[model samples]
Structure formats: structure tokens, C-alpha cells
Target: MTEKEKMLAGLPYQAWDDELVILRENAKLLCHQFNHLAPNETAKRHTILSNLLNIKGQFHIEANFFCDYGENIYVGDNFYSNHNLVILDVCQVSFGNNVMLGPNVMIATASHPLDPVARRATEFGKPISIGNDVWIGGNVSVLAGVSIGDNSVIGAGSVVTKDITGNGVYAGNPCKFIKSI
Candidate 1:
């Protein structure tokens, strides 16, 4: 299988593969243009995002949004992201309806192997799924292979390392369960 196929399958892949490098460069260029678009060019922004990602319904992402492999990211209806949103979508990153993300929210699917030798050779990724009606606050770093269930809220500055089930507020570095709504 090709390196991109391995990446899509959530397996270890050579990050420096020529095709993947070209894809990343293309995404970066598109993101750069989207980020630099005039504030009045709302329709163009929407068009760019629609072309860049697998999206549905009405959505808005503020300036300075960045992603790797825009094709691997999908956002559902009524999605909104604040400024400085960065998604490292080495694997699929899917978001359900009505998801909102605050500024500087980093959603990453890429990770390195624990073995030093392997880490330098190949990189792996896991999918991240965010269910409906989830609100993620600012400066939240979501690691690979995490699923945030429906009606969940992640507090600002939280580092999410594990799966978060629905109907609760999660906070802190390790992301603990707070009150349930």
C-alpha cells in the first residue's frame, strides 16, 4: 500500500513520502490563502473551506486556521471554529453537528512511536471523533484516538489524552470529568 493509504488506514507511514509532502504543501497553500482572505470575503471563505474539507451544513472558521491533509477532515452542520484553529489530520478527524471550537484549539491525530528508532523512521495516526453539540474551549490540545461524545464541553487549556463520553464537562491537563449536563 502507498504511504497515504497507510495514513488513511491509521497505520504507521513514512511522513516524507513525496506524494504526502506535495499534499501537505497544497493544503498549506490553500490554508494560507484562506487565512489571508479579506474579512469581507465571507462567501469566498466558505467556498474555500468547502473545497478544502469534507463539510456539510452552515459553518464558519475564523482566520489563521491550519490543517494537514484537509481531505481527511470532516465537519458536520453548524460547525464554527475561532481563530488559530489547527488540525493535524494525518488520520480522519470527524466532527458531528453543532460543534464549536474556541481560539487556539489544536486537534491532532499524528503521534510518534515510543521506540526511539521507530519514532525517527515512521509516524502513525489515529482518528478523532467529536460528537454533536460539543464545545471545546481555547488552548485545548486533543491527542490522537480520542472521541468526544455528544453534548460535551472541554474546558479551556485542557489537554485531552483519553476518550470523553457525552454529557459532561471535562477539564484540566489530563481532562477529568466535572459536572454532567
Candidate 2:
């Protein structure tokens, strides 16, 4: 399989492969263009995002947004993200409808091997799935392979390292359930 195929399949792959590098470069260029546009240039921004991401419906993301591979990021309807959002979507990063992300939220699907020798030679990633109507507060970091269920609220400054069931408020590092909502 190709490096991109291996990456998408959650298998170890060389991240420095030529095809992967070109894809990342293209994404970065598009992100740069999107981020540098005038605040009032809504139409232009929309056009750029449409070309970059797999947005299912209406969505709005503030400036300073960055991603590893735009094609690997899929956002559902009514998605909104505040400024400085970074998504390292080496694998699929899927967001359900009506998902809102506060400022400085980083969702990473990329990971390195634990073994030092293998880590330097290859990288791996797992997909992240966020259910519908989820609200992630500011400065939250959702790690690789996490699935957050629908109607969940993640409090500010949390680091989520595990799957979160729906209809609850979760907070703190290694985010724990606070109370059912």
C-alpha cells in the first residue's frame, strides 16, 4: 500500500514520503491563504475552506486554523470553531453536526511509536470521532483515537485522552466525567 493508504489505515508509515509531503504542503498553502484573508472576506474564506476540507454543510472557522492533511478532516453541518484551532489529521478526524470548538482547541490524530528507533522511521495515527452537539471549551486538546459522544460538554483547559460517553460534562486533565447533563 501507499504511504497515504497506510496512514489512513492507521498503520505505520514513513511521514516524509514525497506524496505525503506534497499533500501537507498543499494543505499548508491553503491554510495560509485562508488565515491571511481579510476578516470581512467571508466569501473568499468560504471558497478556500470548501476547496480544502470535506465539509458536509455550513461551517465557520475563525482565522489561524491549521491542519496536517485537509482531506482527512471531515466536519458536519453547523460546525463552528474559534480562532487558533489546530487539527493534526494524519488520519480521519470526523466531527458530527452542530459541534462547536472554543479558541485554541487542538485535535490531534497523529502519534509516534513508543520505540525510539521505530519512532524516528515511521509515524502512525488513529481516527477521532466527535458526536453531534458537542461543545469543547477553550484550550482543550483531544488526543488520538478518542470518541466523544453526542451532547457532551468538555470544560476549558482539559486534555482528553479517552472516549467520553454522551450527555455529560467532563473536565480536567485526562478528562473525567463531572455530571450528567
Candidate 3:
């Protein structure tokens, strides 16, 4: 299998492979263009995002948005994200409909090997799934392989490292359930 195939399959693969590098570069360039556009240039921004990600229906993302391999990221209908949203989508990072993200939210699907020797040689990633009607507060970091179920609210400044079931309020580092909504 090709390096990209391996990467998508959650298998270890050389991140610096030519194909991967080119894809990342393209995504970066598009992100740069998207980020630098005038605030009132809604049509242009929509055009760029349409080319970059797999977005469904209505969506709006504020400035300073960045991602790796935009094709691996997907956002559903009625999605909105505040400024400085960074998604390191080495593998699939999918969002369900009616999701909102606060400023400085980082959703990452990329990870390195624990073994030092193997870490330097190859990188791997797992997928992240966010269910519908979820609201993630500011400065939240959702790590790889996490799933946040529908109708949940993640409090500000939380670091989510595990799956969160739906219809609850969760907060704090390593995000624990607070109360059912």
C-alpha cells in the first residue's frame, strides 16, 4: 500500500513522503489564502473552503484556520467555528451537523509512536468523530481517536482524551462528565 493509504488506514507511515508533502503544502497554501482574505469576502472564503474540505451544507469558520491534509477533514451541515481553529487531520476528522467550536479549538487526529526510534521514522493517526449538536468551548483540545457524542457540551479549557457519551456536560483535563444535560 502507498504511504497515504497506510496513513489513512491508521498504520505507521513515513510522513515526509513526496505525495504527503505535496498534499500538505497544497492544504497550507489554501489555508493561507483563506485566512488572509478580507473579512467581508464571504463568497471568496466559501469558494476556498469548498475546494479545501469536504463540507456539507452551511458552514462558517473564522480567520486563522489551519489544517493538514484538508481532504481528510469533513464538516457537516450548520457548522461554525470561531477563530484560530486548528485541525491536524492526518486521518479522518469528521464533524456531525450543527456543531459549534469556540476560539482556539484544536482537533487533532495525528500522533507519534511511543518508541523513540520508531517515532522518528514513522507517524500514525487515528480518526476523530464528533456527533451532532455538540458545542466545544474555547481552548479545548480533542486528541486522536476520541468520539464526542451528540448534544454534548464541553466546557472551556478542557483536554479531551477519551470518548464522551451524548447528552452531558463534560469539563477539565482528561475531560470527565459533569452532569447529564
Model 2: residues with Cα > 4 Å off, grouped in runs: none
Model 2 residue 52 CA deviation in Å: 0.5
Residue 168 error for model 3, in Å? 0.6
Q: How many clashes (backbone N, Cα, C below 3 Å) per candidate?
A: 0, 0, 0
Pairs that collide in candidate 2 are none
> What digit string (tens of lDDT, one per residue) describes model 2 on residues 47-129?
99999999999999999999998999999999999999999999999999999999999999999999999998999999999
Scanning candidate 2 in windows of ten residues, the lowest lDDT window is 64-73
C-alpha positional error of residue 147 in candidate 2 after TM-score superposition, expressed in Å:
0.3
Candidate 3 lDDT tens digits, 111-167: 999999999899999999999999999999999999999999999999999999989
Which sections of candidate 3 miss by over 4 Å?
Answer: none
TM-score, each model?
A: 0.98, 0.99, 0.99
Q: Which ten residues in a row have the lowest lDDT in candidate 3?
A: 66-75
